[model samples]
Target: MESYDFIVVGGGSAGCVVASRLTEDPDVSVCLLEAGGTDSSPLIHTPVGAVAMMPTKINNWGFETVPQPGLNGRNGYQPRGKTLGGSSSINAMMYARGHRYDYDLWESLGNKGWSYNECLPYFKKAENNEVHHNQFHGQGGPLNVADLRSPSDLLERYLQACESIGVPRNHDVNGAEQVGAMPTQVTQLNGERCSAAKAYLTPSLTRPNLTVITRATTHKVLFEDKKAVGVEYGLKGQRFQIKCTKEVILSAGAFGSPQLLMLSGIGAKENLDVHGIPQIHDLPGVGENLQDHIDLVHSYRSSSKRDTFGVSMQMVVEMSKAVPQWITRRSGKMSSNFAEGIGFLCSESDVQVPDLEFVFVVAVVDDHARKIHASHGFSSHVTLLRPKSIGTVKLNSADPYDAPRIDPAFFSHPEDMEIMIKGWKKQRQMLESNAFDDVRGETFYPVDETDDKAIEQDIRNRADTQYHPVGTCKMGTPDDKFAVVDSDLKVYGMSGLRVVDASIMPTLVGGNTNAPTIMIAEKVVDSIKQQYALLKQTKTASCEPS
Candidate 1:
């Protein structure tokens, strides 16, 4: 029976920003509902605790893709954030805004006011970069971004190897260029993880206009005459309904948002009928055009004494020693981002833009969740920047509690496989480069150097998702049958409902999705503010002297 001016569903990266921004107006009451518990776990706060969260279900949705034909019918594991801050709290914390061309593509696809120039301000608005303060970065913003302090000496050599391989060294990936190997900047504040909850929600929780309810699973959006009026959700074991007087915003990320929309009978008619849900709207794009980045990790042991993998125990001791220094001076090993560095390279020499991207991790990551070797090692993960393959997401059953079916269909396109192969070959070349001549050790993979078939088979067996999902509910012109939302992010055939999460992206951004999702929320918040202000002015003028 409770009612509010606005109801925002899901407290992930985008929802947190939306709820926080909407509640800025003292008169506008806002309610935020999250399916997971509070982000109070120590793993959620520590910078290096992401590894622990990967296997646990406490803060993850733990959904798996249906058998994918692209990878020899293997089901890919997809872990999504289920907690208050969502995946931002569990992610590797790499702060990437994606290529400027990515946003320009959105503008070209009929998305007005979504060009790189127009969206850059929002990116700046959300960031409090501790490194630089020029046009690309802001001084004081909600999200804190800073450089990693404890990079391994081997990582520095990896960067040099990239340069030696004709890849330029980028000073700032978020700046003018995103096409070079650079140390990753992370979302951290004073060595602690800075999730969306920490950046936006924590500060706004005490506001009287804001109410945050966790462990509340939203069942569906209540609609009257095709307009969203409220939501029905349950917390713990109790069920309740809350009305939205103004709007219902869905920020349930790429998977959850689309699943909620479909459950509410707002998706494709055929799908709704199959799931035994009555169709309210026949929008077909609710769960189509699924996209994600597939990553292949290459691990190598180090012969050089400087490799961090060999010195992990020493590094731990060093970190312990440096923690006191960090507490006193706010600098040292405690400030490292763990993903020490990254690189962007072109798989095809003639290609103008970088087609392959690389991330260098200080730890040895072999299996999905298992790192067997105790020796010193580093991981070079290569991902195709632009994948040609498209996939889909659907409901497994009519029940709202059932997890939706997801199919990433990675490497469906032959070009994607080829690109990955080229990237893998490049990884080997980098390891053999003179920069690593003294430091290079044994290759964990491709144990039989002479078996070409084994190398290809190893790639298929080892590939895993990079966890960046998008384009399930894409933005496009109405004529585009699969387009769920218009360029302005307004859902088709809906009066007061909008989706402002990663689901609105027409395609996946080239890098980490956290920054891009936050940017979308920032842009949508401005749009909502302008519309609400205009409505208020109109009502006030009409009431005066009438």
Candidate 2:
């Protein structure tokens, strides 16, 4: 068995960072296990190639949610990156740090060292924003956050339309306030995608102490009573065990992390009994507090169609030309993240912070761009940022290879639906403004927006995930019965094990979860190092007098 000081599972956003940062000491040996292959695909490297990955399994785990009762019993499409960067590899590449209050809320929820001031350092530590080098964003870090290498005039018109609707243009959405529209900062370095792998893992691969094994499916954590000592995984049709001398970190994301927990018999006692699996520790909150932002897209046909993303015969010609340009200089229409512009706002003015998010895509993205259209158009997504509805990820079987059953019970709260209706009305008002008159062609959805009932129906029919799934293994105080991890991200009642990912978020942040997820890894790894400082001293003493 290969022995390591730290064993990090799932080489997605958090796993990659955990492994990369831990190996920086050179004395620490870290092993990262990813079920998918390396993030070496060309599509995974290009910004616009996310469209191709969203619909297919190429460097992605295109998992579909169980039928959502709140969404008219429709199954939601969830495309998570299975390769090295994980979802960061295949995501839309928007670099949003979420609202500052989001972290304050974490602190308010009985979690110390999670206030905006405390968490800001971690956010800045992992960020390398090309612009906005102030107290809010960092200039040099592993994760590259840059402005759009190539933005379309159509996006400018969209911003203009937002401005006309009394919405101010935010120079930086990740700045002091996150309530206005602007060009999205992307995870790109010189026009190419800067996934977690490209930022942290790739640069650290030369370290002889760090070992990354891809295409390795982890079954469960091997525990000595309550202490997680190692992980049993499979590779090349063979089962292998690797022991971790220090700790086992589960960075398997929101869904996969909890599923792995349940598979390891560390979930609700009843769930473990139903599956005929032996229980290790009965932690009722292991896979319970699931949440995600539900998005309702309002797509419109673009009269000009020249700049927007669509599959017109003329667009096909343009794309063919753009591909060569992108190949040569890494700058063209092919460099777009598709979701170029975004904004955050409160659905109701009474709320302290923005509760809704608007994502403006250059393409008429119907169904995450799964619905192909031959015409030129644009789409705006109105996301219910803090949905009241909770969801879950449960193990379907004892088999680790089986996909977990995911049900993000969206729109379950009547208030959430009401907010969606408000967002729809606001979104429509923005689109119908005179600023978009030159380019806005026609409304593709809402057969009739005659009344609030009609608008509500439209939202229910169109509402789906914005792909930010989180809070499966919640971080809470010990009194919180549903809390899975503590403020230090240590799993409850477990020794030498922790869940460090979006799953630990008690509440979903007000923006994209990618940057926050990376921040969690950066923050937690520091805590791990502090907690395991004695191990270093023990090793040094063994090499000295002994």
Candidate 3:
């Protein structure tokens, strides 16, 4: 069996950062296993490649949820990245840290050392923002964040529309306040996708102590009586085991991490008995409390093709010219991140934090863009930033390859549905503003916008996930029985194991998840490094000329 000081499973957003930073110590040996291959595809580097990746499995896991009764029995599309950078490489690349109160809420939930004041350093440590640099933003960091190169005129109009209405304009959402409209800052460098792999992993290749294994799927965590000592994985249908002398970290994302734990018999005992698998540890919270940002999109058709990625003969010709423009100058329509404009707002003033987040796209995106439209158009994605509904990720079968049963339980809560309708009403308010007169053409989503009942019906028929799923293996204090991992991220009642990903979030944040997921890694690696140092110190003391 291959052995290392630390073994990190799932080379996604958090895994990449953990492996890279852990190996910074020349003495520590680290091994990173990625279920997918390298992040070297042209589609991965190009900013506009998300359009194709949203539908194809070239770099995506392409998991589909069970039929959601809330969305009129619709099975939502869940496309997670299956490559070196993980979803960070496949996501919209928005660099948001949620609101300051979001982290404070973590502290309030019995998770110590996770407040906004404590987490700000880690956020700063992981970022290298090109435009903003202050007490909030950072420079000379591993993650590269910048503004979009060529935002569509329609995106600008959307922001103008936000201001034209009562909504305020925020230049930086990741700063002091996160309650207004602004152009999104993306995780990009030189107009290319700066995924976690690009910012943290690629540059770490020169370190001889670090090893990254690609296309390796983890089957289970090998246990010694109770403590995890190694991982059993497979590649090309062959099984292999690797020992970690110190720790085995599950950074396989929200879905992948919980699924692996349940497969290894560390989840609910009742569920394990159903599959006839022996229980290693009975943690009922292994796959419970699943939360996601449920979204409702509104679209409008426009006449100009050059302004959007919508279907048109002029768009085809313009795209032909865009190819060379990107190949040479790295600037043009190809440089757009598609979701260029963002807004965060409150449904009710009594609510302290904003519950609604709007993402303005340059093209018509519906049903994960599966059903293509004929006309040029733009879409406004109004997502319930924090849904109260709960869900689960249960095992389909004992087989490791089988996908888990994902039930996000979207709109199961009556309040969530009401909030969903309110979010769409806000989207309508922006669309109806005069800012869209020169650009906006025809409203196509609600059909009838004024009726509240019609809007609620529309939500039930069309609402789905915004691709941000979290809290399966939640982080909380031990008093919370269903908490999977503690404030330190160690799995409850287990040693030598930890979960570092979106799954560890006790509650979903208010904005995009990619940036917060990376920050989780930066914070947890310090914990890992300290443990490694103690292990080294104990060994040195024992050998001191005794």
Which candidate tops TM-score? 3
* Candidate 2 lDDT tens digits, 139-226: 6899999888789887888788888876789999888888899999899999999999999999999999999999999999999999
Extract clashing residue pairs from model 3: none
Error of 2 at 471 (Å): 0.6
Error of 1 at 239 (Å): 1.3
Estimated TM-score for each candidate: 0.95, 0.97, 0.98
RMSD values for the candidates in order, in angstroms, are 2.1, 1.6, 1.2
Instruction: Report model 2's TM-score to 2 decimal places.
Output: 0.97
* Backbone clash count for every predicted candidate, in the order shown: 2, 0, 0
The C-alpha stretches of model 2 lying farther than 4 A from their native spots are 538-546
Tell me the lDDT of model 2 at 26.
83
Q: In candidate 3, where is summed lDDT lowest over 10 consecutive residues?
A: 440-449
Residue 386, candidate 1: Cα error in Å is: 0.9
lDDT of 1 by residue, 319-355 (tens): 6777687677655554555578878888978987677
Error of 2 at 73 (Å): 1.0
Q: Sort by TM-score, best first: what order?
A: 3, 2, 1
Error of 3 at 103 (Å): 0.6
Model 3 scores a C-alpha lDDT of 0.90
